[model samples]
Structures are given as C-alpha cells and as structure tokens.
Target: MSLDKRKQAFINLGHFLNQFNSNGIVKKENVLHNDLFFDAFKMQIKRAEEYNSWFTQNNVLFALESWTNALHHQNIYEWLKDYTIAKDSSKTIAIIMAGNIPLVGFHDFLCVAITGNKVLAKLSSNDKYFIPLIAKYLEYIEPSFKGKFMFTEEKLQDFDGVIATGSNNTARYFDYYFGKHPHIIRQSRNAVAVLDGTETHEQLEALSDDIFRYYGLGCRSISKIFVPEDYDFDKLFKAVYKHKDILKYTKYVNNYDYNKAVYLMSLFDMKENGFLMIKEDTSYASPIATLFYESYTDLEILKEKLNNDSDKIQCISTELNIADSVKLGQTQAPKLWNYADNVDTVKFLLEL
Candidate 1:
C-alpha cells in the first residue's frame, strides 16, 4: 500500500479507539463497523483485563485513548512530516513484545507498518490477543494492509530485521541471536522525578499518576525521585493519597504487602502511607508500590548525576524546568515523536 493509504487506515483505527475510555464504552454514530466491532472491541477489552490483571479496564482504555488522540490525520502528519517515508520494498520485521503494560509494543508495530514493512511478531504470552485483532481491524479498514502483519507462536525465522524489547538479560540474548541482522533491541529503563520542595500540592498529586499508573509496570512510570536533603516526605505522601484506592487491587496489594514485609525484616528505613512507600535508595528500579528516593545537595550536581545515568533513565519528570524534563503527569501520555530509549524507531525502520 502507498503511505497515504496506510496512514489513512491508522487514522480511521484511531477514530474507532476513541469510542472506549475510562468513563464508559459508548458506541457513537458513523464509527466504522460499529455494528460488527463496537461490541467485539468491548469484549476484547474485558478479555484483555481477564487475561492480565495489570491490564485493568482503566489502563486498557487509557492506552486506547492515548492512541486515539495520536492517530488523527494532523497528528500523524506532524509526526511523519520530517521523515522521508517512501513505500519501499517490504521487509519482514520481527518484534519481540513485552507485556508489562497494555499495548506497549504497538508503537514499534505502527512504525514498521507505516513504513511499508511486513511484521513477524512474537508476542509476549502475557499479552497475546489484542494486536492480532488490531491487525484484523486494519485489514478490514484498508484491504492493502492485509498480509502486512502477522503474529506467530512458532519460533521466528526468515525475517529480514528484528526489534526486541525485554529485560536487560533478555536483551543480551537478543543481541547474541540477532547480531547478524539489522535490529533494534531494547532493555528495561525507568523514569525518575526530581523534586525541589517548591512544587504545588496540585503538581505533586499529578506526579502520583506518573508513579502509580498501570500499577507501575510501564517503563514510563516514575520509580525513583530525587529530593533535596531537607525535603519533607509528608507532602508527597499526602499528594499520593489521592490514589489510595489502588489498594483495592489484590495483585498490587499482594506486591505491596510482600515487599513491605521484606523491607521491614531487613530493617530498611522507609516511609509509608498505607498504600505507597517511599524509601531512601540510590537505585532507580524500585519494587511495585514502593518508590526509591535520594537527596540532592545541588541542582548542578544532580544534573550531572542525571547526565551520567542517562542510559538508565527514560523521561525525567520535574517542575524545575530541567533539561529533557517531562511535565508532572505527562510521561505515560507521550506524544507520537517521543521514542522510547531516546532512539528513533522510525529512522531505524526507514534505514532498514
């Protein structure tokens, strides 16, 4: 298919996804194939939640909603405007998806598809169903998209290029296996927030969403924070209390209870407010329901520290107007151009 045809198909798919949200799944008039798909899509959302506890309806809808906002004609054009995306000869691109959060791997798929490459995806067992259904939806919307993407349970073979997302360990394995092929293999990364004690209660509360959304499974979720030496934890605790209802999820509560017990037995110094925990830690990757924190003596020194550890960081959220700082609550709601790992997937795909 031509680039315009492929782009139009995704824009239409965005219109379809706009129907579902956290408020409620309301089918609207003039949506494509609502008679056949609206109910089916709703059922798939339920099925996604049933298959993965982290795939809560709220989280699934949020992912869909993010895509809906991104898939508009203007947004797509803006994202692709700089790129010279020619519908060249199709190459099969293999994707090893990670299922930590709902639809986490869709951007890679979208990049490959939009650039006119065929997809051979080895989906995470934890997240197996939805993308294939999306492929079907794309096929129906643009007949040319048919046969452009396919999923497989069997061992991947005969693909021209590879794009894998996994833990650092799995990434090592991917590097060994796909070393000969042109590839984009990724490792786990975490986001951190720097606090200066000047943030409003409103900003701090908004920061809670950056920390707790998707049960802290997404790479974009804030797992660590940098606070000044004299910063108070009470303000953060109070702000995060807005999400205290997260205690209702058994999976999260179990993780919270187990991690808390281990920390207590180990005599780790930490603060908790029933639902979330904040510990003085030097590390970036914290346990679920727990956030690691460190004290910064000066913004200049902290900036250097952040620069040194940039490889381990994703988006940094703060209100200090720091370099590359994402807003308090906008990390998970990334724009189309905000490539993960700071690597441009579109440029990578186009080069292949």
Candidate 2:
C-alpha cells in the first residue's frame, strides 16, 4: 500500500470503529454490562476468559478506545509513515506474548499489524487462544492481514526486531539471546500508590479495585502504599475492607495464603486475609495479593525516589500532588492513554 493509502487505511479503520455497533455481538458474546461503554465493555468482558485476564471483553473496549485515542493524539498514522514496510513485506517480527496479564503483548501486536509487518507470535502457555480469536475479528476488517500473522511455539531467530515480555529473571536470558539484536524487552514491573488523607470512603473502596482487580496479577495493580507518617492506617483498612467480596476469587485467596505463610515463617508481623495482605515497608509495589506500607515525609523526595525507581514501578496512583512527568491513576481502571508498564511503545517500535 502507498503511504497515503496506508494512512487512509488507519483513518478509515477509526471511522469504521466509530460506526461499528456491536450490540448484537455483545449480547451474543455474553459480555456483562457496566457503566463504561455499556455495549463495548460487554464484548470485551466476554473476550477476557479466552486468555490473559487483561484482554477480557471489558478491557478490550477500554484498550481500543485508549489505543485509538492515543493514535489520534500522537498522529500515529503520520508517525508510521516513515516506518511502513511495503517493499520489505518479507520482514517478519517475532512477538513472544506474555500470559501474565491479558493481551500484555497487544500493543506490540498492534505495532506489527498496523505497520504491515508480518507477526510471528509465540503464545504464552496460559493465553494460547486469546489473540487468535481477536485476530479473527480483524480478518473481517482487513482480509489481507489474515496470512500476515501467525501463532507459533517454536523458538524465534533472525527476526528483524523482537518484542518480548517476561519476568526480571527471564529478561536476563532474553538480553543475552536477543538483546544484541534489535528488540524491545519488557521486564517484570509493579505499580504503587502515594496516599494522602484526602481520600474519601468512596475513593478508598474504589481503590480496592486497583489492588484486587485481576486478582492482583496485572502489572498496573498497586502492590504497595505510601502514606504520611501521622496518617491513620485504620481508615485505609476500613475502606478497603468494605470490598471484601473481592476475596472470593479462589486463585487470589490461594496466593494470599502462600504469601502470608511465607511472611509468618520469616517472622513478619502482618495482617492477612483470604485475598489481601498488609505488610510494613518503604516499598511502592508488592507481589500478588499483597500490599506494603511506608511513611513519607516529603513529596519531593518520594517523587525523586519513584522516578529513580521507575524501572521497578509501572505506575503511581495517588491523591498526592505529583508532577505531570509521572503517570497518575485515581482508581484501578486506567484511562485509555495510560500505557502499560510505563513504556513508550510508539517510540520503541518507531526506533525498531
């Protein structure tokens, strides 16, 4: 496709999306309704059970809206002008998908798909079916892209640019293997929060979504809490405890048990329940189904520390007065433009 044609293709896709009424699909797909995009969210929630928890019907709506808005904001069609791979149709991009969360590899997939590069995707064991089904929907939108994407189990080599998502430990292996090659490696990360006394009972209850949503498996979930020294922890606990129904997820409870026992064995004085934990620390993010608390005196110092610790942090959700340089989240659900894992995806792929 010509550059103009490619740009128009995206623009046309956006327009089509606006007109794309999926009410029937939403009902057929069994997407439960919520306040956010009542129709679209239902479709996405239906898609959630197929793979990574993050890519569900609920988030897909949010993802598409956010991703689409971001594209418009960044003028991605123009940014992609120079990166279009027309003559190099044979160039293949290898994507090692992460099953830790839903569609964690999706933005990278979009990079390849929208840029017209062939994608050789390696499915995570946990999310083997999610992407393909969504891709099937794409086939209806762009029939030409059908053969351009592939799901694979074999090891990848000789790909132009690799995008791999994995743990901090596995990142070392990816670095040694594909690091020298042109690639973007997303290592493990966790998000945290800096809380002031300004939070209300309602805000605190909503904050529970930030912690327990997806059973605390997502990278965006708050793993730790930072508070003022004189702040009352009881109020925070009381607020979060109101949403105790979230603890019913069997898998979440299992993780809480595993972590709580480990804490007890190590002599850590902490409170635990079926789905959440309260640990004391100067940390921003914690492990699954766990939360760490720390006292901060100065917001500026905490901001510096958070910026310094950006690699370990995915996002900082707070009522604190944070600079615009840092990303902010009020509750659990992220806004459309909030990039995952704090990575500059367009820049990363454009460089590739």
lDDT of 2 by residue, 39-135 (tens): 4434545756654443444444444444444445246544554543452255688898887655566667766776667788998887665467556
Return the lDDT, model 2, position 7.
Answer: 46
The pairs that clash in candidate 1 are none
Give the runs in model 1 whose Cα sits over 4 Å from its true position.
none
Q: Would you give me the overall lDDT of model 2?
A: 0.64
Q: For candidate 1, which ten residues in a row score worst on lDDT?
A: 83-92
TM-score of 1: 0.98
Model 2 CA lDDT for position 167: 86
Question: What is candidate 1's lDDT per residue for 51-170, written digit by digit as tens?
Answer: 987899999999889899989899999999999988745689999999999889999999999999998999998888878888889999988887888898998899989999999999
